[model samples]
Target: MARKAQTPDIGPFDRHSISLRVDHVRQLFQTLDPYPFTERDLDKDAEEFIVSWARELTGDGPIRIVIHLPAQEASSAEGRKLGNAVRRYFEERTRAVSLDLRECFRLGRLSLAIGASVLALCMLGAQALSQHSFPGSLQSFLTESLIILGWVANWRPMEILLYDWWPIARHRNLLRRLSVADVRIVAVSPDERSHPPH
Candidate 1:
């Protein structure tokens, strides 16, 4: 008898260490550009962009960066000055260009939920149809199949809806922090510590 493959345990630290992809950040930026820019918007964009760039440059490895800035609105002179100073600090400190990408976290969550629900519904319908045998009515089958397929196909857009529903998820700290850089060009082997040490 063949042994079934065991799924590895994932720890909080392991999950935290996961990095967002560059393309993902780019898409996020595209979404945010349509909205009017605000201090909060600038901050969120800065943090997400830095995090994404850091991941890309460091090869999707665990890292942390500390951001410091004055508490002021960017519309004000003091705020603008502080923002520029922080920008320069990052420009000098990090390897990649500063790109603004605001929070799409809520959108992402929504997208997941929508996709999951759609997939579940489709699976349920398929099972029902298979069990009962297809009814010979072409119109009914076509209509039902189209509805299921439409939801499945639209799963990609769930992310956008997620963003809209949740306001908090859209606002991220302007000053982001990352620490202890370790670059892994390819996915790393699961750390032995992933499981409780015997």
Candidate 2:
């Protein structure tokens, strides 16, 4: 297996390289996909491995993906299309994640509207109860319950707006970076390809 490339200092920004070794370029793509090479999805394990490594990467450095394949396979027509296939896969993922983020925000907005309306009604109910004559303990309990229920109604919207969207947005950004990442294929000896580094 080819060793990971050392960090590059070509420009002001850093360059990070993520490397992997496989017996053939085809191993990097989903075998079940009937689409042509450039439009095919990446293999699930391969995609997960690449994305996990990307998430661990730091800095605003440019990203590159290096795939090591057997010399014979590396020089083949399929290998020539590997980079484009990888880019297209990630581009599709980026678009899908963008949709997820948009849907998340839409749900958040709708929930917020519902939550606010419920809260307003609850507050009004509590305020009306406060002015009515009732047993002291019962009145206190009802008022407190209304207030608590009102806040509870807002829980989903607050969670969606404040916390849930972050990871989705971050994932979308990650996929976008990977979609444009430079991809390089390195030729390796058959022996090295057979026993790829762990």
lDDT of each: 0.39, 0.84
The top-ranked prediction according to TM-score is 2
True lDDT of residue 99, candidate 1: 22
Predicted model with the maximum lDDT: 2
Off by over 4 Å in 1: 1-102, 133-154, 157-198
Q: What C-alpha RMSD separates each model from the true structure?
A: 18.0, 2.8
Model 2 clashes, total count: 0
Tens-digit lDDT track for model 1 on 1-198? 011112233342343333322211122222445543221123345555555544443333334322211222223353334334434434433322222222344456666777777767776766666556445785468557856785765656664654443433222221222423322211222352143222
CA shift at 28, candidate 2, in angstroms?
1.2
Off by over 4 Å in 2: 1-15, 191-198
lDDT of 2 by residue, 108-176 (tens): 999999999999999999999999978759999999999999999999999999999999999999999
Q: Kindly report which residue pairs in candidate 2 clash with one another.
A: none
